[model samples]
Target: MNQHRKPRAQSAFTQRAVRVGLFAAGAAGIAGAVPAQAATGLPQHSAIAVDQTFSRADFVHHTQARDSFTVRQFGTVNAATARNQANAVGVGCSVDDHCRSVALSFQIVTMAGEHTHLNAINRGDAVNEHCDGCQTLAGAYQFVVSTPRPFTLDKGSQQKLADIHRRLDALTRSTLPATDLKTRADALAAEVNKVLADAVAKAPKGAERPTVTLHRHLDGWPAH
Candidate 1:
């Protein structure tokens, strides 16, 4: 009876050892499969709560803490067809190994300019750009060219611009998903298209129609 009992005890101990060994191997496999960052308890990508709720004070605080860039290309070009070109006019700034929000405002204001071409472009990857991973929070470009040459902006065009301005203001203040922001941006571009078309139609014949091309590119959003 003693011999049978000893053999049974040894068998149970062997089974337990096997189970422990299997568990250890499984744990090792799982650890090996994990990424290097995970192994080091570091996150590869930080999360951005696009649709998170925050107060106006919080928005102002974040905006003030980050970098801001404003540019105005104002003046009249006497030439019938004047051209103004700016590349990477305004950009954002990074901080604390992460990106911060930035505000970029660009305006082209002139009085009575005929056949002017305004090009304002902000490419995120400029050679001297400092905002490597910065996000654009508020951005706008106002192109106002008033001419006394019998060219008037119709009410419809004015309304479109107003609507775009309102939407842009809301976007600057609200927290929205990237996709949603992109949709709104596309809509704004569409409105701009209509305004341009209207301008062409209203311009007198044999005159160089004033043209303005504004391009703004920001991180986490499509180019506008």
Candidate 2:
């Protein structure tokens, strides 16, 4: 009985080994059947940049004897810029396996400057999306830096200037009668001149004016 049991055990072990070997051979065959391109996969990378600049100059001269003249100049500038850099890598997929990868980049910068005195520079990569193994991801990054001409003004004068800016914005957007809007805008212009004169007259003697630089950074996914 012991001898018979020994032979049965040996037979079972041999059969299991044969099954394993067959399975390995079949797996190798399937792997070999896969296209070389699919086995090595493909990688993609893209980069894009957009740059724009605008400049305008207007000169007006009028000579008249005993005549009152008023000149109003209005200008508007709108600009948009976007930079994108994307990279996608696929690490191969088996014949019986499904694998997908996606990479995307999107960027948009919009600015509306009234009176055309604003200078905007958009630089650097704004978005990067990475994915591996059927994963999906979206990302957006933005860096904004603003440098303005240095100026020294008292706190009161600063507040006045802020108020003037608000009023001007409102007047521009108002739906009131065209003549009324014009009148209000003209008044605000006069106020601006007066504020500038007062600021210059009351400036501190030998005041140390420091240049200010502003930096802002945004990172994450945006809805819509």
Candidate 3:
């Protein structure tokens, strides 16, 4: 009877050891899965840019005229495209109790990365009042431009959409202003409109084009 009890005790001990080994193996598999889960949840980065500009002008008397132009850009734009995106030219004159100021601001953003350079020129003398066929009297203007990276949307593309929204908000709130502010905002708007129209025309069928919205404010200029 004692020999029978010894064999039974040995059998029970072996069974308990096997159960413990199986539990440890299962916990190890779960630990390995944690990294794979984290990798799936990581956000994928994409390149995008949103550029906007605003211009203001004010004049007092024939001799004292002031013009200001402000340009702001957000997001990561390609260096080459941004370098040559916009060109602005202006001319003004003050002569014989007559003074005038004119400014033009232009900018473009394309699928191709491009740089935008702000150009401003002031010419006119009170004494000579020589008008070199220059025009004056321009008003404030505003422009909005966007360039989205190409992508294909799948059924489960919610994560991609969220990423785009995040980038848009970042660009909208944080704008880089140019050193000089003398470009006509309206002229810039017209240029951006043309760019958007061209983009719409060139888009592929079934492709989702970027959305644009305009916001105007009577409040003073925005802080840099």
Among all candidates shown, the one with the greatest lDDT: 1
* Top TM-score model: 1
Q: What's every prediction's RMSD, in angstroms?
A: 27.1, 33.5, 29.4
Once model 3 is optimally superposed onto the true structure by TM-score, how far is the C-alpha of residue 208 displaced, in angstroms? Answer: 5.7
Model 2 over residues 153-187: C-alpha lDDT tens digits?
A: 45886688677766654543344432443345446
In model 2, how large is the Cα lDDT of residue 74? 12
Clashes of 3: 14
The TM-scores of all predictions, comma-separated, are 0.41, 0.25, 0.25
Off by over 4 Å in 2: 1-151, 204-224
Q: What is the C-alpha lDDT of each candidate?
A: 0.32, 0.25, 0.25
lDDT of 2: 0.25
Q: So what's the TM-score on candidate 2?
A: 0.25
Clashing pairs in 1: none
Q: What is the per-residue lDDT of model 1 for residues 1-224, given as tens digits with 9 covering 90 to 100? A: 10000010100111111101101010000111111111111212211100011111122233321222121222333222111111121233334332334333323332223433322222222111343333333333333343324344557766766666666556644565435654575566556656755674565543344443434333331232
